[model samples]
Target: MAGEIPRAQPPPAEPDPVRDAHPYVLLWQWRRNPLRRRTDRLRAWIALGLALFVLLAAPAAMYAVGDTVHRHYRSTAEHEARTRDQRPAVLVHDAPRHPEPGSDEARETRYPVEVRFTGPDGAVRTGTTDVEPGLPADSTVLVWVDAAGEITGPPLTADEIRSRTMGWALLAFLGVVLAGLAAHGVAGLVLHRRNLAGWDAAWADTARRWTRAP
Candidate 1:
C-alpha cells in the first residue's frame, strides 16, 4: 500500500436540500477562508437575506394581496347584489342572429340591443343589453338593472372571484421574487466590481514597491 500512488479525491457534489437543510450551502462563503474577500462575505449575507425574503416576506406579501383581492371582489359582489335587481325586459328590436361576415366571432355571440324594463323603483327603463343571437323584436328577456335603473353587467360568480384572486396573488408573489433577485444581482455586481478594484490597487502598490527608483 505504501508503494501505490494515492488517487485524487472526487470533487464535492452539489447541495441537496432533501439530504439536509443545506445551511452550510448558503453560508459557505461566510466561512473563514484565506481566499475569501470581504465582498464574498457580503454576497453571502445578501444571499441569506434573499432566501429569507423568499421564504417569509414573499408568502406574507402573497397572503396580503390575495386577501385584499378576495375582500375587494366579495365586497363588490355583495354591493352589486344588494343594489342591483333583475327585471324582465322586452326587446325593442330584433337581436343580431348572425356574426358579421369575414369575422372571427361565433354564430351565437350575444349582441347589444335596445330593451325596455321596469327598474327596482318600478319606473320604466330603456337601455341597451347583450342578448342571444336571433331573437325577434318584442321578445321577453331578463336583464340586470342598477338602483338607478341603468343596465349593468352581471355580478362576479364565486368561482370567478376565487380564480381571479388566485391569478393576481400568484402574479404578486412572482413579482416579489423577481424584485428580490434583481436587487441581489445588482448588489452582487457592485460588490464584484469593488473587489476587482481592491485587487487592482493591491497589485499596483506591490508593483511600485518592487520597482522603486534607485
Candidate 2:
C-alpha cells in the first residue's frame, strides 16, 4: 500500500438522516418565504370572490323564481274568479243529499251555488254563487249549475295566493344559499391545505438536490 497504487475502497454509504427531516424543514422554510406568502394572499382573494359571487347571485335568483310563482298564482286566481262571475245559472230538479243515512226531504230553493269552472285555457277554477237548488229527487237536492253545467266553489284572491307562495319560496331559497356557502368554505379550506403540502414537498426536493451536488 505504499506507492504501488493504493487500492481505493468506496466511500462509506452515508445514511440520509436528513431526507425524512427535509420535508418538515422545507415546510417551515416556506412559511417564512415571500413567494408562498404571496400565494396565500391570492388564495384569500379567491375565497373573497367566491363569497361575493354567492351574495350577489342568490338574491337575484330568488327574486326571479319568486316573481314567476307570484305571476302564475295571480293569473290563476283572477281568471278563476272572473270566469265564475260570468257563468250563467241553471235550474236543477233534485233533493238535497245529506251526509246522514236518512234525513228529511227538504226542498228549499236558494240562490248562489258553488260551482267549478274550466277556463278556455283549460285551467280548472272554482267559485261560489247565490244560485238556488230546486226540486227534490230521492232526498238529494240539486244545486244551481253554471253555463257549462259545472259546480262552483269559493273564489280565491289573487293577491293572497301570490303573497303566501312568494314567502315560502324565499325561505327555501335562503336555505339553499346557506348550504352552498358552507360547502364552498369547506372546499376552500381543503384546497389551501393541499396546496401548502405540495409546496413543502417541492421545496424539500429542491433543497436536497442542491445540497447533494459537488
Candidate 3:
C-alpha cells in the first residue's frame, strides 16, 4: 500500500475566456470581484443613467416638444382661417393652352387664368391667378382673398396641420436621440481616458518597486 502510486486527479477544466468577459461588461459594477475598482462602478452608474435618459426622458421630452409645436400650429392656423376669406370667382377668358415655360404653373402644375369677382367695395375686379388647368370660360373657382379683395394664401387645412404635427414629432424624437448618443459617446471617451491613465500610474508604481528590490 505504501509503494502504490496515487492516481493524479483529473485536470481542472479550462475556463472560457469569452464567457468570463460577460457581454454586458457594465454589469461588473454590481458583481463582486477583486479587480472591480471605484471608477468601474461609477462608469456603470453613468451608463445606467444614460440608458434611463434615452429610454424614458427622451420620449417625454419628444412628446412635450411635439405637443407644444402642434398647439402653436393649430392656433396659428385657426387664426388664419378666421382672418382669410374664400370667394367665388369666374374665369373671364379661356386659360392659355400653353403656359409660360418658367411660370408658377410649371412648378405647381396649375395654369394662370384671368378671373373676375366682386370686391368688398362691390365693384367688379379682374386679375390673373393660378388655377386648375382645362377650365372653360366662365367656370367658377374659389379663390382666397383679403378684405381688400387682394389674392392671398388660404389657411392651413386639417390635413396640413396633421402632417406638420407628425413632422415636428419626428424631428423632436431625432433631436433627443442624437443628443443622448452624443452625451454617451463623450462620457465613454472620458472614462476610457481615465482608465488608461490609471493603468499607466499603476504600471509605473509596479516597475519602480521591482527595480528597488535587492
Per-residue lDDT of 188 in model 3: 66
Q: Rate the local accuracy (lDDT) of all candidates.
A: 0.80, 0.55, 0.75
Winning model by TM-score:
1
lDDT of 1 by residue, 1-214 (tens): 3334333333334334446667775566767878767777888788888988888888888899999999999999999889887789999999876756335574447889999988877788799998877789999999988888899978888998999999989998998999899988899789877876776677666656556655
Cα lDDT, model 2, residue 210: 52
**lDDT-superior candidate, 2 or 3:** 3
Candidate 1 collision pairs: none
Candidate 1 has its poorest 10 consecutive residues by lDDT at 2-11
- 1-214 in candidate 2: lDDT tens per residue? 2224232333333223257567654344235554445545555566567667778777877877787777777777777666654433222324234344333433334444444444444566554444324424222222333335455563567668867777867875786688667866677677667666766676666556555635
Residue 92 in candidate 2, Cα distance off native in Å: 15
lDDT tens digits by residue: candidate 3, 102-128: 567655677888899877778889877
Cα lDDT for residue 143, candidate 1: 90
RMSD in angstroms between candidate 2 and the native structure over all alpha carbons? 14.3
In candidate 3, residue 146 scores what lDDT? 71
Candidate 3 clash pair list: none
Which model, 2 or 3, shows the larger TM-score?
3
Off by over 4 Å in 1: 1-32, 99-108, 210-214
